[model samples]
Target chain A: MKSWIEKQKYIIDFTLSSLLRRKVKNIGLLILYALIVFILASVMFFTHAIKKEASLVLRESPEMIVQKVVAGRHDLMPLRYRDEILKIRGVQAVEGRLWGYYFDPVFGANYTLLVPPATTATEQAETEPMRTVVTENEHRHGPEEQAMPLVGAETIGAGNIVIGNGIARVRNAGKGEFILFRTHAGEGMPLRIKDTLSSASELVSSDLILMTEPDFRRFFGIPENYVTDLAVSVRNPEELSTIAAKITRLFPDSRPIIRDEILRTYDSIFNWRGGMMIVILSAAVLAFVIFAWDKASGLSAGERREIGILKAIGWETSDIIRMKFWEGAVISLTAFLAGVILAYIHVFFTHSLVFEPALKGWSTLYPQFKLMPFVSAEQLTTLFFLTVVPYTVSTIVPAWRAATIDPDAAMRHTGE
Target chain B: MIELFDVRKVFNTGKPSEYSALNGISLNISSNKVTVLTGPSGSGKTTLLSIIGCMSRPTAGRVKLSGREITSLPERFLTDIRRKTFGFIFQQHNLIKGITALENVMLPAYPLGERHGPLKERAMHLLDRLDLSRKAHSRIEWLSGGEAQRVGIVRALINDPSVIIADEPTSNLDTKLSYRFLEIVETFKKDGKTVLITSHDPLVYQASVVDEVVRLRDGRLEGEAP
Candidate 1:
């Protein structure tokens, strides 16, 4: 083995130079390998980034929010509950929420306008800053829906409204422009677009519009004393159980929601999507394994003879195995890097083009999200395992066989 | 020394259509001698060579190299033995068409694990010795049959193996080229290496340097070797 290693420097040099001699074939293999790596890595990277972003937003979101049962229905909870709910010791703050939907009757495109709370009083203090705010709301696909989250405005301040980029694009309206929305009551009310919310909520953003609480209620003909839901903030997040128990007992009509609950729901969705990604990734991995197996198994007699001759000439089986292992490594690593780079570019700059297809639901989305690329250690580890490990293992058996064959048989184009 | 003691090789064993290629062939090839296994098309001459080369295993019986019984060893172990002790020159030269002459000559010894500097020097030295120094970097597709054969000879000799096995060495060569190949084999014999040449050509039989000629008929020896 020591002697073999001493010889291997020569073998590796020769293998590299020799493979280079067959530039066309090697390049062809390289491109095919790169493509596979790119697709798998991109999907994995993008999904993880989306999942992380969704979880971040979901975690910071309000605890138990109450909305009307009907789709597109925003029933007002009387402002009187502000005091009624505030009296509950666990409930730190009770604020009214107003949500409105805007539709451009011409193109049938829609936007959701919302007015949510000011998480930091300073954040919403600058009335002239024109910042867009987003809050978690029930995203309805149709009549029958569970806990699909939709992005809504944080506060209904006044005439100031916020919309999404997609809504801005589809309606051809930007900040400082009037967006006309026909509410559920079928009234065409116009409000000046103040700020467009930049969100990572792909499914929710495209059709979302935001308005001040007063503007939303006024535009929707909602009573001044009523609101769609209550945003309940607890004094102690860890004391959620005690606080939630107090709120539920005090106000049986309203539900006590913890931020974790909303986060968990979104996490489940992200998990489901992640699970699906795993399924697709597994399929890709299977394809890679099968392709590698078939390719190795289908080695022509001529190629096998080449391996034999290599062995006959004093090349060790281990040397042959190493050469092939390097080949697989080179191909997979190249592909993985390219794929990850492309995905990063797509998420950060292109907003994940591939994800757009999956993000688009049946109904028109009001506003589209700006997905950011995130790289975590766990994700990198996963990507590495998924991409490199399988390819490495895939080449093992064939490499071993090629390595162990009698050099004489190899040289003579015969096998054991 | 290469010795085969009643080596038997079978193909597709236990199947309905099983066949045996080498049937108890026994022979002893001493060092520093040129031995030819001459026979008609399917007399198992190549099969015998393959077994002697440790390219395949015997179904029964034993074969040894320098007194080491190799027939029962695992394939990889046999492969190691072959790498260190055997050299093979195929009928077609079998040079990788895409690589240069020097590279093709260096192919066999590549897996032996030598460093780049020494490997290059050694490969160049062999190519030079084979009178192929000028065409060292030229691709095999551009080399003539005679040149390719010489390269093949260079490849076989690179590892300094104990035995040189050539299968139909001169089939693609003209008479002059054939003599040149013989001269190469003669040099190896002078170096005390055992040389096994498989060919049915009369010219090979007539070579004065050949120590023995074993002819085969139907996978069996025709008579006592002349």
Candidate 2:
């Protein structure tokens, strides 16, 4: 085993020197190879980071959200449905949620306004029910659980709002400042900014506004007994499907968006994005494969002559093939590593400029947050087999052809 | 001892370009002697040398090295015989470019899986004997023609094989370098190595160290030179 390793070491050293000798020729291929890897890896890293971010943010979300549907469109839900939902078995709690999108023509962006359950000073002990809801749903061990700030009646008083970091950045508003938006009555409704959401939750909370229930209802002109949706929590998670079915049967014109379904949707979205990227990149990959094949098949005169000389000097066919394999392995592995590192830096550190717009989709207010770096061993392995194996195999036919020829004839061919 | 019996090599057989390079040639190469084969460009001298060196296989007939027939051996065994038994010096001096003289000399030993320290030591010793130690670190392109050829000679002798097969060893050398090359061949002969050379140059054909001079014409051995 040691002797075999020593032989490989010698071959690798020789291969390195050989590659360095032809830097001008190999560098072009290396750059192209690394660029392709960088592009694909950046896409993978970006999608993986987005998926991770979604999972973290969604961890604390309600298990199910029941929305009333009218003529295939979501409509405001009546507060009486909460009582019906509460009576169902396995239904732990059902809270009426007041949330609606408010369009600010000034910034030409839409911000989500959410009115959490009332929290007043008179009921201090039980005042912050929404804060309890968020804390209860928080992940046992996650950065979001620690990073998110707890809100109460004092933090968000009537007619005041806690704005997301992205919204604050766009409106140039700070704590104790006022953000003016048009109400349903076409009148200006100015809400005082009480606090800003943490940057860590910016991926999901971007362009969000958290306010009191009365303020939200008054601003949107919603009826007193109406809410945007009903957030449902289940006592027994395994019976969630049965509860959802019961709720659906009770209200035929309603849709229950389960947490697991939302997660599956996110997964499918990312997978679809990845699939589209593969389709688009397929042409480039094909071009690259053809380029590799052409480069390998058309061995230059000097290269052929070199192989001939090696054989003439008593090197076996296997030796020549092994040398060629080392050469290909060295080049491909270098390109793969370089590309992956650059992609990691690009996606996690510098916000994947080329791929961010495509992956993030079109949004008026883009999140100003860095993606968490997440790469799996399977991804690295896939890239290795995809790039290195094909390249090394492409070299085999040409190397074998050169190695098996009569050394004298090959040396004299001139390969012009 | 090297012996060939009814060796025949045909090129492009059954094609319009079919041509026989060697025709029923049989000969013996004695051990520890400098034998020269002199012929014109198309007289099959190089082809015969290639077959004898195991660089190629004869289309027909048997070739035996030390009375062991190797004509029908597989390529793997043939490669082993080539590595362990013969050292080749081509007419072009076929030194791989972009490598140092020392590296070129050590190329043949790489496949042998020899340890680098000893391989380098052996190459340096051979280079020193050829007065090329100074140029050992220089790339092949930087060396003079004679220096490169001397490097090639050192490379061939690096393995210390018993047989040295040189094709037109003096073709690229001037009169002074030609004698220098022959002197190296004479040194190999003195070391009891069997040396076979093909050349039309009378300088090599008439060298004092040459034990026998065979002549060939039209792919047939004419006879030993008088």
Q: Per-residue lDDT tens digits of candidate 1, residues A32-100?
A: 556566565566666665565666555545765644333444455666766676787666666666665
Docking class of 1: acceptable
Clash pairs (backbone) in predicted model 2: none
Model 2 chain B: lowest-lDDT 10 consecutive positions: B217-226
TM-score of 1: 0.82
The C-alpha RMSD in Å for every predicted model, in order, reads 6.2, 3.2
Model 2 misplacement above 4 A = A1-5, A118-150, A410-416, B223-226
DockQ of 2: 0.53
| Candidate No. with top lDDT | 2
lDDT of 2 by residue, A276-298 (tens): 88788889988888887887667
lDDT of 1 by residue, B1-226 (tens): 7788887878789998988777778888888789999998878888888888877788888998889899888766876777778888888777777778887876766655556577778889988887999999998889899998898888888788889988988888899999988888888888988899999898987798799999886677887342
Each model's iRMS: 3.7, 2.8
lDDT of 2: 0.83
The candidate maximizing DockQ is 2
Error of 2 at A341 (Å): 0.7
TM-scores for candidates 1 onward, in order: 0.82, 0.94
